[model samples]
Target: MRIYVNEIKITDDSIKCYTEESTEGLQEAGQMLVDSDNYSFAYILDNGQSYSYLIFVQETWSMLHENKGKKIIINDNLELEQFESEFNYILDNIQGNLNYGKEFVSVVEDTFELE
Candidate 1:
């Protein structure tokens, strides 16, 4: 959904960044995006710093799917009430969607941080 780069908010739809060395060494990884349209809607990353891919998707799902079940550093300060409301909204709205996986709705709180 949202990634903080040096504490700057970066959403999934943001533009991509890359380093010079990656141009050749990561040719296959580069091709991974160029060759597939489905994945084009997203970016694949291996957890490096600075230069990385910018997945093309909505903020929340991208973050949820990308970092599923993984421990990530989130904002140290956040609003608990607002977070719970948003999480509940997502769960209630998308809960019955089998394509998105019914499990996803229940998993909202697991993917976010609320101080």
Candidate 2:
């Protein structure tokens, strides 16, 4: 799966994002990557400006599991040809939050535990 950050194209090599098929058949949200990895998700959000995320959680309540390779989510749902337009207006709004963000870092340091 491919996620676009502005003109920068981020592929599956760095991080993997995906959804799990829930028992109820609804797609549950989750991501899979190294526990110590730092991931940056640009929140202006597009199916363009959006920051697609990945995490490996031990808890099933969150619906994220790390398992066999191809089955794991690299990118899903966000890459629709129909939604493939540039996120022009959304990108404009990002400057406001990042400027005043005392807590929010551009590249976020998110560490997960095995539990």
TM-score of 1: 0.25
TM-score of each: 0.25, 0.22
Error of 2 at 41 (Å): 7.0
**Overall lDDT per candidate, in order of appearance:** 0.32, 0.26
Cα lDDT tens digits for candidate 1, 32-55: 121122322223333343334433
Residue-wise C-alpha lDDT for candidate 2, range 7-109, written one tens digit per residue: 1123443223444421122232322222212222222222333334322232321221122111222344342221112212222333334552423222221
Which 10 residues in a row give candidate 1 its minimum summed lDDT? 26-35
Clashes of 1: 2
Model 2 TM: 0.22
- Which pairs in model 2 have colliding backbones? 31-54, 31-55, 45-49, 45-50, 46-50
